[model samples]
Target: MLTPEFSITQDDDFIFICIKIAAIRFSAANLEMLVDENLFIFHLSPYYLRLRFTQHLVDDERSNAEFKSQDETIRIRIPKATKGEFFDDLDLPTKLLARKGDILGADAVKAPSKSNAGPLIQEIDTPGENGNLEQAGEDFNWEISQTPMPPSDATRLLTSKYGFDDNYSSVIGVSIANGNDINELDDPEKSNAEDRVQERLRKENLKFDPEYYVSEYMTAKYGNEDDIQINGIKSLLKFTPPLVKKFLKWYKQADDKEAVMSVEFTEVEQQQMQKNLPKKTYLVDDVKKLYITMLSLLFAYMYEQVENEGVHNTESAWTIGKLAPQLSFLDQQVITESAASELSVIKAIVLTGIRRSLSYPLHRNFDLSIKVWNYVYYTLRGGKRLVIQALLDLHEVFRFHDVYYVYNTVLISDLCAWFIIAGNENIIRSLAIELKKELDQVTKKDIDFDCVCGIDESSGEVSWENMNIEEMEILSEQEYLQQSGRPA
Candidate 1:
C-alpha cells in the first residue's frame, strides 16, 4: 500500500504543505490535523504524516485548511513561527506511523514494529459466535454469550457512559444544569437587587410588558456558543411529539394571558396600534418560562453563529437586542457566504420553531413568536432603508413554512400590519401585495369549498358561497371591533 506523501514549502510568513491523496478514497472526515507548539500531526485515517519545526509555532486556530480532492492533494496554509525558514527541510527529528492502523479508536501512537503487513481492517467481537458464525462449531465460547451482567452493575455502567451525576442539589429542586444563578436563586439577601424576575407563572394577571420581557431575554445570556444546548433545541425541532405538546400547553397559557391582557388594555383604551398588537408575560413566566429559558439559553449560540463571522465590538452585527427592531447589518448576499451560514441556520431554526409554535389550535403562540420577530423589526426600526430587507426576510421565513393559512388568515391582520404602522408602510405594503399574489395561487388549490357550503351536517347551519370567509378571518381585531360597533 502506498501511503500518501506530502511536500512542504515555506515563505516569509506562511508554511504551505501539500499531499498527493487518492481522490477516490479520501474524504473530509477521513482526515485529522492536530498542531502542537512546533509539531504538526496529519492523520488521514490509516495514513500518518508528521512534521516537526525547530521554531515554536502559534496555534492553528487561525490557520486555514484547504482540500482539493480534484487536485488530489490538501494544502494547509499554516503561519510560520519565525520570520525565516519554518523547518530545516520538512525532515524533522522524528517521523512516526501508527502500529495499529485503526483510525477511530487509535489514540495511542507507537512506532510500527518493522511490519511487512500494512493497512487497517479492524473490529471487536463482543458476544460469542452462535450458529450463524463459521467459527461457532469449535472455536466459539457459548458460555460467554450466556453470561449476564448484574442489574445494578449494568445500570451503573449505563449511567456512567451517559455522564449522569445526580447530586444532593437536585434533591432540593436545585439543578446543576439549571443555567440560572443558583447563588441568586438560593439566597434572597443576595437577590434583593432584583426580585428574581418573578419567573413563577400563573394563570391570572399575565405580565406582558415588552420592555421587561426584552430585558429578561437579554439577561438570560447563554454562552456565545454551546455544543450541548443547541443540540437539545435541534432535537426538539425534529417533530418531537412530546415537545410539541409541551410547547402548545405553554403557548395556550401565553395566549390566554394575551387574550385577558388585551381585554384589560381594551378597557383602559390604549391609543397606539402597537399597544393593541398582542403583549404578554415574558415567555419565562410559567410553562413559557421553561420554553423561554431554553430560548434564552440558545440566544448566545445564535449570537455566536453571527459572531463566528469574526465581528469586532466596533463592526455592526446583529444581536438579540436588535433583532426585534432591525434587520441584520450583514446583507442577504453576505449571509449566503460561509462565515454567515451559521446566521442562516439560526434563522431557519428560529423560523421553524416560531411557525410550529404558532399554527396550532388550543394554543396562542403568536405573542412568543412576535417577541422573536421584534428583533428584526427593531433592526428595521433603527433604519428605514432596512424596511425592504425586513419585509423580504419576513416573506422568506413565512414562505419557508408555506403555511398560507397562517400568513393570509392570521399574519396580514395583526403582525405585518403592526410593522407597517410602526414605521414604513410602503415596504411592508409591497410585501403584502407580493404575498397576496402567492396567496392567490395557493388559495386556488387549497380552497376548502365544502366549508363554504357548511358541510358539517351535525351543526345544521346554512352557508353562502358568496361569503367573504378569508377576508373576515383575516380582518384585524380592531377592524372586526369597528365593524361590530365595539370600542377600539
Candidate 2:
C-alpha cells in the first residue's frame, strides 16, 4: 500500500491529521481508521498510512473524522488521552514516524528458539514445475558481464572528510612534514606593516558598538514619531520576497552545467591564498558540525554584502574580519595538531552568523532581524554548490570596485577550507538528515549572542552630554528608549 501525503498539527487537546489523496473520491464507508493507543492506522483502498506517536490518542465522542470533497482531503481529529497535555516534537514529522522498537529501545519482533522452530520446505523435487529437473541443480549466471560504473560527483566528494583532494594538495596541504621552522619567515619591514594593520584593526573593533550603530540608524530614520517611515526599510535591512526570488534565480543560473564552473583565481592570487591556508592539520570529531560552521561564516559574509548594497570595500571587509573573531569563539579554541571535537566550532560559527547578520544589523527591531535571519538560514538550504556560486558571483560584484584583500584572504580562506573539505557533499541535505531532522530547528529563539560573544549591550550606551544641543532636542533619551524598547 502506498503512503499518502499527510500533515499533523496539534494545540492542547486534539491532534489534527490532514491527509491529501489527490484525484480520488472517497466516502465515509470507503475510509477506515484505527487508533490503538499511540499507533494510528488510516486505510483508504490503495492508500495506507501508519503513524506512531509518543502521546496516547483516543477516538472518543470529541474525536471526529471528515472527508472534504472540495480539497480532496481527509481530516482526522483525535483527542489526546490526557487533555491539555502539550505534545513535544510535533514539528519534527520524522520523529513522529518512529517505529515501536525505536521508541522502546528494543526489537519489536522476537525470533523463536531453534528448538521450537520447524522448516516448512520439504524437498527440492517440488521446484521442477516445468518438468526440467536438470536446470534446478545447474548454476545460474546472475552476474552479467558489464563495465564498472564510474563514481558519481556526490560519491567522489565523500572521499575525504576535509575535502583535501589531489587537485588542491599544493594549495591546501603542506609541502613538507613538520616544516614550520623550515618555512620562510617574513621580512622585518613586512612584519612591522602587518603589526600596524593588526593594531589599527583592533582599534576599529574596540570602537564599534552594535547598539550605537542601530540607535544612530534608527534616530536618523525614525527620530520624529510624526514622520515615522518603514516603506523602503525592508529593501535595505530585511530579505524581502523580491530579494529572495532574485537570489534564487542567480543561484539556479550559476548552478547550471553550461555556466562557468570555477572561481577562476589568478596564479598570483592562488599563491597568496596557498600561503594563507592553515599550515597545520586540525582534527574535527564531528565532520557535519564543521561543515555547518563553515556555512555560517559564508552566510554571514553574504549577509554583509547584502547590507552594503552589493558593494565590497576595504572598510566593510575589515569590520567583518575583526567582528568574526569577536562574534565566534574560534579565537578561543586551542589550535593544536591534535584533533578536537567540532561542537565548539559549530557553536562559534552559528553565533558569529547570528551576531553579524541578525544581532548587530538591526539594533532597534529585534523581531525584524529575527525575521530576516530566518530567510538567510532557509536560503542556505540550496546546498554548498549554490553558496560557492553565489560567493563567486559576489566576488565579481566586488571586483568592479576597489576590492579588499581582507575579504578574500581572511574570510574567503576559511570558507574555502570548509568548502573544499566537504565540497562534494550536499551540506544542507546532510544537515537535515544527519545533523538536524528539520532545518527550522535553528530558530529565532536561538539568538543568544551577547552571552556567547561576550558583548555587554549596555556598555556602549550613547552619552547625553556628548550630544549637541540641537541633536539632543531632536531625539530625547526617553523617546529613544521607548522606540528601541530598551530599559533606561
What is the C-alpha lDDT profile of model 2 across 93-154, one tens digit per residue? 33344455444431222333335333211121121121111221122221112222245645
* Clash count per candidate: 18, 2
TM-score, model 1 to reference: 0.19
lDDT of 1 by residue, 1-488 (tens): 33455666677777777766764577787778877776677778666666555455666565877878678788887887666754542421111221122111212223223232121101111112221112211221111111223556644342211000111012212221343221113422222111222211110012122223222232222223464254233222222222123333443455332111111112112222122222211111122111122222222222322323322231112222122111111011112223232433223224323322222111212333333333322222122223322332333332333222122122222232322222222222222222222222332122111223345588976663432223323334445458769785
- Per-candidate alpha-carbon RMSD to the true structure: 26.9, 25.0
Clashing residue pairs, backbone N/CA/C < 3 A, model 2: 162-421, 163-421
Question: Model-by-model lDDT, in order?
Answer: 0.31, 0.44
The prediction achieving the highest lDDT against the true structure is: 2
Q: At residue 336, give the lDDT of candidate 1.
A: 24
Models 1 onward score TM values of 0.19, 0.36
